[model samples]
Each structure stands twice: as C-alpha cells, then as structure tokens.
Target: MLLELFTGKCPIDECFSGDVNLPKWVQSAFPENFMQVIDSKLLVGDVCNEDHDDGDGDDDDNLYVSPEIQVEYCLATVIEIGLSCTRDSPDGRITIRHALQKLKNAKHNFLKNRNGEKM
Candidate 1:
C-alpha cells in the first residue's frame, strides 16, 4: 500500500507480473539510492523559492532547505517505512504502531526542514 502510494504504481502493475512484485521492485530500487524509484510527479519544483526579500531587498542565499535535499530525505524515509512493512516475514516487519510513529517522525522532520514551504 505504501509502495503504491509513493510510487504511483499499483501492486498488480504490469511490471510486477513476474517474480518481482511491487514490494521487491521497490526494495531493489531503493536502499542504496531511492531517487531512481521515486515518482517524479511526487517531487517537482522547489518547496519555496528564494525570491522573497529580507528587509534589505537583497537575495537571501542562506536558505538551506533545498527542494531536492528536502524531498530526497522525506522520500527516503517514506520508502524505508514501506520497505519495513513489506518485509517477507511478518515477524521481521515493523508493527503498525511503529510504522505510524516512524511515518509521523519522518513527516515531522521533513516539515521541519522545509522552512515553512508550501506543498
């Protein structure tokens, strides 16, 4: 479910017709580098542009919340949660409560880095 949500690819997607299902595909896509697997539509443009004036009307190049970095961090965390949920063995998988807490933490951290940027 989480894989489908973030990847925009259904569990029964044509790519998952063989031994590689959605979970496996997603797992292989991430772990090392998840950028290749993330749906482009989910991440586009900057969270907030640097066009705003800070009293002096000069360009403020100090904003550290880069769109790429912010989105990358959030997506990585999300994919990690999804991968944990999709573990082969239920005993090794994360609990629903644990997953939810991790998700909340991811969101909190993601937002905190956004610097009040709108989605």
Candidate 2:
C-alpha cells in the first residue's frame, strides 16, 4: 500500500516511516511524509478494516483509500519528484506518465519481495 513518486527507490523500510534524515530533495519530493501526516489523523476505528490488524469490521475491505485521495496524493508526489529531477537535469522537465511508471515498478518489486517470489 506504499505509494511514492520518486524516480529512484525509497530508502526507508516502512511505508509511513517518514524518516526525514534522508536528503532534503527526497523529503520534499516523495509522498511518504505527506501520507504519514494524513494517516496520523486516523482514530483507532477510523481507518478501513483491512488497514488495521483486527480486520473484523463488516464494511467492505475493497477500498482502503478513496479514489480522490489517491489521485491527489499521487499527483503531488509526481510533481515534487519531477521538480527535483528537473532541477538537477539539464532538460528541466518530466512527464506524468514516466513518473507514474516509476511508481509502478517500485510497487511491483516490493510486492514480489513480500510474496517471497524469486526473480
């Protein structure tokens, strides 16, 4: 469930760890910290059943995050990451599609590792 928009991989182990000790560019560019801020407001019972370990709630578990929130978070992260890259690169720009593809690759690798599937 970790969502990020970095051109490179995340350095921390946890999705919401929000370790700010990394480079400033990463801190500003990734959505990890931003997501942490949003998640911190969740009361004990506010989050979806699946997000919690208890998982006994009757509500459907299909949608842990609403589509609107997902879109906003994703876009913010992409913009920040793109800005950082453009700042460093001579081209001074990035495409939304490419940024999203990087996120997809990171998620695929993470899921494969978690599932204990060998490469």
Candidate 3:
C-alpha cells in the first residue's frame, strides 16, 4: 500500500520480473534519483487540486497542496518502511508494531512541520 502511494504503480500489475520486485526496484533508484521513483502526480502537487465551478462559469477556485520538505520526509520514511518490510530474510524484516510506530512518528513529524510547530 505504501509502495503504491509512492510509486503510483500497482506492484502486482507492474512488477513481474523474476529477478526483481517492486521494493527492489525502488530501493535501487532511491539512493540517487529518489524523486524519479515518486509518482509524478505527487511531485506536481496534483493530489490536492480540486476543480470546482462557481455558478458563473468561472473555474477559478482550485485547491492544491504544494509539495514541501515535509512531503519528502514522509516519502523517505515510508520508503524506509517499505524496504524494511520487503527484506529477503524474515529476521531482517521489521515487525508490524515497529512499522506502525515508525509510521506514527513520521505522521507526527509531518503534521508538526505542517503546523509550523517546533520539533
């Protein structure tokens, strides 16, 4: 689910190579070109853009949340979680509890930054 959010590609539909999976593909490109792996829509801040017509045939009201540093941090956190969860060895993988905690922390930080609260 997190991987889908970042890459905007369904793993079952897009990643089919026997030698590599979605997580591996993301991991390989993350170190250098992380933005390239992210969904273009996300990079363009399209998720929050809503088109609403205000009676007068004027579609001037558009709501958008521009991508910021917090977005990058959140993406990085989720990518780390995805990588941890997809480890080849079960022992190397993080438990659900740990993953949840990490997610919560990321969410907290994102919200904090969004609110302009000091960390």
Candidate 4:
C-alpha cells in the first residue's frame, strides 16, 4: 500500500508478463537506472486545467515532488525496503519492526536534508 503511494503505479499493472515479476522488473533498473522506473506524473510541478481555464493564467498546484538528490535517497530507501520484504527466502525477509525503523530513519534523513541539516 505504501509502495504504491510512493511509486504511483500498481506493480501488477506495470509488470504482468509471464516471464517477469514486479520485483525483478524493478530490480533490473535499480542503482544505475532507477530514475527511469519512477512515475513521471510525480515530477510535474504544475498542471493546467484545459476545461476550466478562465484566462487568469494562474498555475494549479498539483501534487509533485522534485527529483532532487535527497528525494532520490528517500525513494531508494523505500525501494530497498520493498525488495527486502519481497525476498524469495523467508529468512531473508525483514521483520515489520525493522522495516518500520528503516522507514522512520529514511523519513528522518529526508526531512533533515530538506531542512538543510548536515548528515
């Protein structure tokens, strides 16, 4: 649920081929080509309404996050967590407590960076 919120796409909808699973598809693009896998809609800053344009020329503030380094770090952290949760071996999977801790740390780091705090 959280993964979908962050990624903005259903894995089943994006990677539903017989030969590939969502995790594999995502893993293939990680570290080197991670940006290619992110949702483009999340990068848009402002959206214009075609039908309700009153010629006022005001930009509509849509929900968007910049692809800055800090944002990328946060995204990478979440992706790593997802990968950990989806591991083939049960022994390799992380516990819910550990996952939540990781997420909290990632959020903290992201917020710290966003607030101009040194690491």
- Judging by lDDT against the true structure, name the best candidate: 1
lDDT of 2 by residue, 1-53 (tens): 12223223353534335544233434464565544333322323422322422
What local lDDT score does residue 34 receive in model 2, on the 0 to 100 scale?
Answer: 44
Candidates' C-alpha lDDT: 0.79, 0.43, 0.73, 0.69
Residue lDDT tens for model 3, 1-119: 67778888777755558877778788888756676788888777423423334345544334223335568778888888988888889999999999999999999878875554434
Q: What is the lDDT of residue 108 in candidate 2?
A: 67
Better structure of 1 and 2 per lDDT: 1
Which window of 10 residues has the lowest lDDT sum in candidate 4?
A: 46-55
> Candidate 3 — what's its lDDT?
0.73
Residue range 30-86, candidate 1, lDDT tens digits: 877677777878777656545443365555545545656677788899999999999
Give residue 47's lDDT in candidate 4 (0 to 100): 31
Clashes of each: 0, 0, 0, 0
Clashing pairs in 4: none
Best by TM-score: 1
Per-model TM-score versus the true fold: 0.79, 0.30, 0.72, 0.72
Clash pairs (backbone) in predicted model 1: none
